[model samples]
Every structure is written in structure tokens, then in C-alpha cells.
Target chain A: MAQKPLQFRLNGAEKAVFVEDGANLLDVLRRSVGDLTAKRGCAQGGCGACTVLIDGVPGLSCLTLAETVEGRSVATAGGLPGDGSHPLQEAFMAHFAAQCGFCTPGMLMAATALLESTPHPDRDQVVHALSGNICRCTGYEPIIAAVLEVAGEGGGGRS
Target chain B: MTIHRGRGFASINYPIGMNLGGDPSQALVHSSPDGKFAIALSSIDLGQGMKSVTRQIAAETLGVPVEDVYVDTADSDTGPHCMGSFASRGTHRVGNAVIVAAKEARAIMLEAAAEELEVNADDLETDGRGNIHLRGAPDRSITTGDACQAAQFRHGKTVAGRGIFLIPLSEVEPETGEMTPVSCYAHAALVADVMVDDETGEVTVEQVNSAYEVGRAINPRLVEQQLVGGAWMGLSHALYETTEPRYPDRSHGPVDFSQYTMPGPGDIARHDIAILERPAPDGPFGGKGPGEMCANPIMPAIANAVFNAVGVRVTALPITPEKVLRGLKANGGARPGPRR
Candidate 1:
């Protein structure tokens, strides 16, 4: 296989790596970039476990071509504020939104996009936004509640 | 083309831990020089909060703060032996082993503290806040860290303990052919409300109300997580999930999540759960395993709900729209049964 050069701003840091042609962004980020936070689950763009921020929009990294992200900004779950202070992370912990946690990074990214755009989405909106992500363990109740809690909507005001 | 609503109910009792020769799990507990305890086990968590629950059991048994305990479920080579995590036995079996190991380590810890304080081991008690004191003498106390340090350096003793839990297998009676398969059981009941469209024969679960009598809720939040998630999985199994839609043919098998069907976040219904605790006699902290039983009742409840909604007794794993329509057509029309 032929290799290609790709450069992207990863989590606000410039990253340059050589990738095989047609390699998806998920493989490049995990295998080359050493960012294992983005999980590889059902790498067919259906599970949404590899969802990442591509230029401030939530996109499936598993389906994205690495060359397309060249010079573009890519953000993963690791980019979330550390120290356990991010509102979504705090809300997730308080609400027990993550189990097994394979889907947490993508769920957080999707919820992050929703909050950034709507800021106070209703229950139906939250459900619609998170429909693509599949969590085998959480039943989607706590995940939705965590996102809604951050939006000051639900979660029993626990957040 | 009208949509009809109906309700159905189901109840079930599930056994905790399998009775295969002796389902055994072992645990090892040892204290570091700083008095922090580490539990080594081969049981896997698999996102079921196994590590967290065992840590709590060890801390409680040792009379120490939960933060002072760490559960290391490393590989089988480094950790002790386990019969694997299945049959919902992680809590009941592994928890008991952890309690036993922690108790032994606690006894050793108290012995070291007694030696340092020039008192009997029976007269010393842990404060659960990193301190051990002589009975009736609050001023005469030593920090757990100091005691552990002394045990390692001055006393030439290792504050460690090993534990294993097993239930002897029951032999079948040749005359009656009866044998005890499990030690304890967890019970659950569920009521499911669903809406069925007469035209397309689509069924949508609207709400679910359930009650679970787990032996005891070791961690109430973790138990709730299991209930909610397990019920969702049940709902999926009843209506959506199928590895091979064309079963015997196996031609159009699903290769990825897109072709595979499961309930999405939008498909989740409203769930109301009530947890009942009737502690088991031989359970750890009077707690039984609630991992696999939470999803058992939803399948039957949904099937009965479909029957009530359209009078079609679709006995298949997934009551898909085609099956419902075929049943409705075969029955000559929509014959709504009595609503539960």
C-alpha cells in the first residue's frame, strides 16, 4: 500500500503523520497519533463510537478519509477539559451515564455539539441528537439525562 | 389504519450463579506500606461495576474508607483464579471472597496495631478513617499507616490474606431425579404498554413499569444501571435484534451496525423502576446478583402486549412488522383482545 502525508490540528495542537492511502481518520488517530480515547466500535459509521469534531461539527471519524482532514481541526474526547470539570463529564458521572464506557467519547462529542448549537435542547431534541450513537449498557436514559442536565433541562437537577 | 393501545404483564425468577461442579472465585487482599489496601482478582468487570462493587465489599469488611481500597482485576496470570464472570455471579461469588479476604487482612492489621499499642488484638477497633484505637481509650490510638509500616518493618509480618468462595455441587437423587441447581434466586415483574398500528402492524413500546426484588442492592445506582440497560436490551431482543434475519439461509447476514437492528436513543421508552430488597441468607451483605435477570421479563411482557393490542400471538423472537401483518391477515382481521 502507498503511504500519504497528512497534517491536521488535533485538539488545538498541530499534528503531522504519514498514513496509508484510503486509511480512515480513526485508524490514523489511534494507530499513529496515539489518541486512544476515540473508541473503534463497529467501524462502519453506524455505531458512532468514533465520532469526532471535524471543524466544529460532529462527524464519524471511521468513515472519514484521513486526507480530507488535512489542515482541518480535529477534536476527540481527549480534547475535553481535564480535571473532571467539563460540564458534560461532570453530568455524566453524576448521572451514571457511562457503562463499559465504549460509547462515552462519541456520546460526549455529540452532546457537546448539541449543547453548543442549541444550549437548551428539549427531551425530544436530545433524543434526536443522540440517536446515532449506540450504547449497549446505559439504555440511553442516563446519557440523555446527563446531556439535558448540562442544558439545565432535566436529570432531576442533580447536576 | 387506526392505532390501538394495550398493556401486558410478566413475572420471573432467575437463579444466581451456576452450579457447575463448584463455581469458585478467589480474591487476594494486601496492604501497602501506606495502609492502602489492594484486592487482586481475575474476575472481569465487563462494564458491570464488578470492580467497584468488590472494592466496596472489601472496604466495608475491613472497616476502612472506600477510598483506601483498590480493586485490581488484572489478567489471570497476575491475579487469583476465577470461574469467569457469567450467570450473574460476579457480585454474589466474588463479593463473598473479597469479604473473607478483607476480614483476614483486617485481623492481621489489628494484631499489628495491638502489638504496637501494647494491648490485646480484641481490644482494638478500626475507626474506618485510617485509625485504630484501644477500646475505651480514645487518646491511645495509632494511625493505620503507622501500624502497617510497623507490621512491615518492625513486626516482620505481611498484612495479606487470601480468600475463595465455592458452593458444593448438589448430587441428583436417582429415585426422585431432583437436585438443587442454585443457592438463591432474584425475582422481577414487569408491565409493558405498547401501541400497535393496525395498518403497518408496527409496534412501539410506550412505557414500562417494573419491580425487582434483588437479594439486596449492594450499589443501588449500579443496580439501576443494570435494570435500565437490561430492559432496553430486552426490548431490542423482542423487536429489533437478529444476527441473521434470513436465519437458515444465512445469505443476507448483517455485517455492521447499519444492517443490524437495535433500539436507538429515540426508540427508548419511559421506564419506571422500583427496587425491593429481601436479603438472601448466604449472600454477600445479603446481596444477590442482578446482572442478567433484569432483562428476562420484558420479552414476555412485550409479546403479551402485542397479543393484547392486535390479538396476534406471534411467538417468534422478534415480533416484526411482517410477522404481525401475516398473523393479522391469517386471522382475517384485527381482533383486539381484552386490554390488561
Candidate 2:
């Protein structure tokens, strides 16, 4: 195992770390960077709990090799907002979008990308955007509603 | 060459907490120097909102604001004993224990306040904002912080309370097969609408409408989340979850998420939930835990729907395509007359 020097913009701040060969981005961020928000649900990428916004696009941190993210910008759930002031975070809290919160970081990152790009995505669009993420507790309705509410549609005002 | 649609319904009842040789949960409530409260318990939240709900119970019992109570669900070594947060017992079991502990701590606060005001303890009441006032005199009141200081310095007493909730074991008549294993039960009914592809034998759940009598909802939103999430888990179990490919043979099976299949966001159907509050007499704030019961009815509802659609009773756990095709071939592809 070889340690490689890696530099990236993490949560709006420049960070540098040394990673082992073949280590994924999640490992470097959690073990080296000390940000435990991006969870390691399934290292094989089946569960999207390790999703991160890489250059404003939702990318699976567990699937991404450390070397590939060199000099890239990464954003996690902790990086969303310090005070839970983001519209999405507020919507999630209001709508009860998170249950166990294990998958919240990835879900937030994925929803963040969708909102940044489309802003007002429909139900199907929201569903497709979050398809990669897996939330075992929320059942996807509240999460979708939170994203839709932040998008300004209120998700048909469903309870 | 034709697709069929069908509907089915199921109703089920599940016990809230089990009495396995005396199921018990404990809580410790103590007041802080700032008049705030801390409750230490061994029950893990597990994302079921235990911390929030238990904190509310403590605050309500102590006549304090919710923000003044801090719930610490530390490990068993440091906190009081809890039977763990399963079997939907976190709310019913832990909640009752918390109320008891909070009540004890509240008594001490009231006594201390009575001494300071030169009045009887019974004449003092809390405003739930950390203020203790006489029954008739609202202005003549002392903050809980003052009472706590008096209790520690003058009275030399620790303002702490301990509580435990337990159910006595029921003696069973083995000859008659009758016994009360649990004290209360939660009920639910669900209707599932589904579509079945005749050629491909693929099934799709279109909608799920359910009504749950959840004793009471401590937090309505958290209950809704549990119902929705549990329904999806039921869907996964009914359609796509299996660890063993062959019976008693683990030669070939899914070892990881990629190999294993569960419902993703795309598979979610329209869900309509009706929450009914039927209070239990012994429940803390009349709440029967809905943690495990949410997944009970969906499996049978989906199974019955597949049968109604194709006139084939596939009794398997997951009504997979291969099994449906085999059943169809065995029945000579005798499709019911277009479900007219």
C-alpha cells in the first residue's frame, strides 16, 4: 500500500491529505479529513450514502478513487450549511425527510445537485434524481417532498 | 398479450411490548444548576425519534419547557438499564419510565420552592418555564434555578430521581394454549393496487392506502415516516429480498448491495396513510409504538393482489417472474376472462 498526497476543495475549504493506493474518496475524507458526515453504507456504491457533490455534480464518494478527485471540489452534508439554514435542510427538518440520518448526507448532496441544476423538478424528475440514493427509514416520500418544497412546488401539499 | 390489474386488502394487529420474563426499562432524571434537566437512559434512538419523544415526556412531567430537558441515550455502562429499542417498546416502555423519573425530580423542586416561599409544597405549582409560584400568587415566585440552589446548599440533597417500568409475567395455561404475552396491541389495515404483466410476469405496485391505529402519535410526522418507511420494507420483503437462492443451500446468493436487490426510489408508489389515535390506558401519553407493525400487512396485501390479477396463487415469499411463469405454464396459461 502506497500513500499518495491528495489536494481538494472540501466543503468550500482547501484540504490536503495522504491516501493509500486504491482508497476511495470516502476513506480519505473520513479517516484523513475527519468529516464523518459522508457515511460509508456500502463501499461498493449500491447504497448512495456516500454521495458527494464533486464540481456541483452528485458523485458516489465510495466509488471514486482518491487519485481521480485530485484538485476537485467536494461537498458533503456537513458542508450544506452550519446552522441548518439551507432551504433544503430546513425543508428536510420540516418535512421529516431524515429518519436514521445515516443516508442524509448523500441524499442532501444528490438533492442539492438537482435543485442547483433544475430547481423546480417534477415528481418523476425528483424520483429519478434520487434513484441512486437509498433511504431505509424515510420511504422516499418525505425526502421527495422536502426537495420539492425547497423547489417551490410544495410537493402537491401532501402530508 | 394482455396486462391485468387487481386490488387486495389486508388487516393486521401487532403487540407493542412483549413480556419476556419481565421486560423493563429504566430512566434517571436529574436537575442541573441552571434549572435545566438531564435524563440518562440506555434506550438507543435508532432514528425512531426516541430522544425527542422521551425528552418531551420528561419536560411535560416536570412542568418544564421542552428545550430545558436534555436526553442522553448513552451506552448501557453509563446510563440506566433499557431492554433495547426494539419490538416497538421504546416509546411505551421508556416513556413511562421517563415520566416516573421526571415526576420524582419535580417533587423535589416543588419542595425546595415551598421552603423558599415559606409555603406548603402542595401550594406551589410550576409554570413550565422554570418558575415556581404559589397557587394564588403568581408574582411571588422563584425560578427553578433558585430552588435548585436552595436544595443543594441548604437542604444538602441531590435533586435526582430514578424510575423503572416493568410488566409482570403472565402465567400461561399450557393445556388450553391461552396466555397474555403483551399488554396492548396496535392495529392496521392496508389496500394495495397493482399491475401484472401477463407476458413478462412482472408486477408493479401502483398505490398503497393504509390506516393505522397507533395508540397515539407522540409526533405525528415521525409516525408518518415510520409508516412510509415500513411499507417500503414490506414491499422489499414481498418482492425482492432473499438471502438464500436454494433452500438450505447458500451456494449462490447475493453477498452485497449490488448483488442483493431492494426497492429504490423509482419503485415507490403513491402512499396514503390515515393515522388513528386510539389511546392505551397504560401507555405514556397514550402511545402504542408503531415501529414494527408498519410492515406487517403489506406482504399479505401484495400477495393477495397478485392472485387476484392472474388467477394464480403463488404462495412463495416473493412472487417473482420465474415463479409466475412456471405457475402460468402449469395452469396451461388459463388466463381469467380479461378480468371483466
- iRMS for all predictions? 0.9, 0.9
| lDDT of candidate 2 over B1-340, digit per residue (tens) | 6778878789998898887888899999999877889999999998989999999899889988899999999789999999999999999999999989988999998898889989999988888887899988999899988898889888887778999999778778889978888889999999988888878888889999999999989888889889999998888888877785744467777788876777788888888999999999999999988989998899899888877887678787787877777777888873552442
lDDT of 1 at A25: 97
User: Candidate 1: where are CA atoms >4 Å away?
Assistant: A153-159
The TM-score, computed over Cα atoms with residue i paired to residue i, of candidate 2 is 0.94
Q: Give the number of the best model, judged by TM-score.
A: 1
lDDT of 2 at B161: 92
Local distance difference test, each candidate? 0.90, 0.87
Question: Candidate 1 chain B: minimum summed lDDT over ten consecutive residues — where?
Answer: B243-252
- The 10 consecutive residues of candidate 2 chain B with the worst lDDT sum are B331-340
Model 1 Cα shift for residue A59 (angstroms):
0.6
lDDT of 2 by residue, A1-159 (tens): 888899999988999888899999898889999999999998988999999989988999988998898988998887867899878888899999888899898998898888888867888899999999988888888898888887785422121
